[model samples]
Target: MRADRLVSLVLLLRQHGRLSATALARELEVSTRTVLRDIEALSAAGVPVYAERGRHGGFELLPGFRTELTGLNPDEALALLVAGSRRGAQAFGLGSALASAMLKVVDALPESYRDTAAGAAERLLIDPETDLLSRRLVDEEVPDAIAAEVLRAVFAGHKLRIHYAAVDQTPMWRTVDPIGLVTIRDRGYLLATKSGADRTYRLSRILAAKELPEPAQRPDRVDLDRAWQERSTRFRTGGDQVTVLVRVNPGRREDLLGTALAVRAEEPDADGWLRMEVSFQDSRHAKWALWQLSMDAEALAPQWLRDFLRNRATAIATRYGVSS
Candidate 1:
């Protein structure tokens, strides 16, 4: 680990030309003391590292010094840079490493493709904090230590003990055999099992974690995609599923389908509107999702859904009908 940190420190100085010990410490996620010791070690090992003492002083690599890295073609360079810009990897505690690796990648690229690829990457945004609709992305935090432990268990086939807080439930500790880790839309999930029963835990809800010495009680080899698909199918079917028939504006059909868990049936109406039967996790989920379309989509069946929406509309009218 120290070796990696030292290499990263050198790369940072080379790329930036000069950096203060404090800045190096922050970038490397270590203390200034460690950075100073690393600098001494590098210098002792004949690295061309030197310190300047003036007010604008810092550490710098010798002029013309460069480290060689694997050469990447244009497309390959661009892809790596784009991936490094995303926050998804942060959920697994690899944010800093990704950043450092990106730096090395850019520096290692051929001069012809380096600037152009980086410039193209800058114009392409993966997951902005807020989209054009002004919706903030939901990104949860996971402590670096906890994520590291989880990753260790998952990769090494070791059982893990975790203190988890499920939604609306008290925190409890459980020993699970971690199967794999999954990340979607910036949220991370641990696909594991307890007592041989399938279990899924949100990485954000892990309060603490411990790696166990015992080998994990999972299959020697797992097809993550198949496992995830099976779990998703079971979850969609076994939950308190509610179905509703709706007529929606043709233009907003995609919007309606996007919010629903699945569409059971769909057909075009005589009036050119879209008639569809959709499934939601529950009645409340159905109501919340349909309400978003407002006048554009109308729930036509499941009389209770219509009644609930009507009541909701009445309440909204009551609150805003009177202009203060």
Candidate 2:
């Protein structure tokens, strides 16, 4: 492990030119004492490393000292190949570029690892379009022109203007300070700010986009993952959520949980079924999810929901000329 840490230390100094012990410790997730020991180890091992002392001083590697990428083991190489096989890059219009880079990665690998890594990657599948139930996964479509422009703005730190179509609303033009882009479950989103307020726009809903010349007024550094989580928490908690007590067959428990926002509590009933208190976004969401299970699930509480389901079922039966 220390060998890996020393290799990382050398690479970090090589890449960053110079880094303070505190900075190195932070990046390496170790203490300053550990960093000092690693630096001593590298120097003693014939690495041309030296230190500069001042308020802005740090450890630096001698110029012209570089390391090769041959240190990657078979497993690490395999992991990179498999991760690169994911289709997320396609959402950014970089599918072809990804393919080219992957070839280079495979070529750079040691001969001993090349065939094993490539064969392992070939055996793994990621994000197939259909599931075991033959249900198609939703892949939101974004025009290449629009995606490219949005990507440019986000990377360039420029304001962006877009013609966006919100749900049940007409398309309208708006300007936003581009923050970053996120892709989840094949759906792309633009995380930005409008008038100092956080805003997230689905990329598919962006009818058109333009990169503006003006610089964006955003923070120099951002934790996009934390920002997205906060927004998601707010959205989940702000909705007209409905909690339901339902009893479901054991075999269908996962199907019931798939659509639920949260499961408050669950226990096995004497009948060997699962009694779960589940939360949905609203009454409609609860109705739709429960309807999917048909006889396998039943709503136990909230007489209104039970009545609604009965009435709907009765109406359906009557339509087919059967007595309700």
The best candidate in terms of TM-score: 1
Give per-residue CA lDDT, model 1, range 198-309, as digits (tens).
Answer: 9999999999999999999999999999899998898788768999999999999989878888888999999999999989988888999999999998898899999999
lDDT of each: 0.90, 0.87
Poorest lDDT segment (10 consecutive residues) of candidate 1: 64-73
TM-score of each: 0.87, 0.68
**What would the per-residue lDDT of candidate 2 be over residues 1-324, giving only the tens digit for each residue?**
688678777767865789999999997789999999999998899999999999999999887776346988989998888888788877776665566566556666766777788888889998888999999987778888899999999999999999999876999999999999888887888999999999999999999999999999999999999999998887677668888999999999989989998899999998999999999888888889988999999998778889989999999888999655
Mind sharing the TM-score for model 2? 0.68
Clash list (residue pairs), candidate 2: none
lDDT score, residue 46, model 2?
A: 100
- Could you tell me the lDDT of residue 66 within candidate 1? 78
**What TM-score does candidate 1 reach?**
0.87
Return the lDDT, model 2, position 279.
Answer: 90
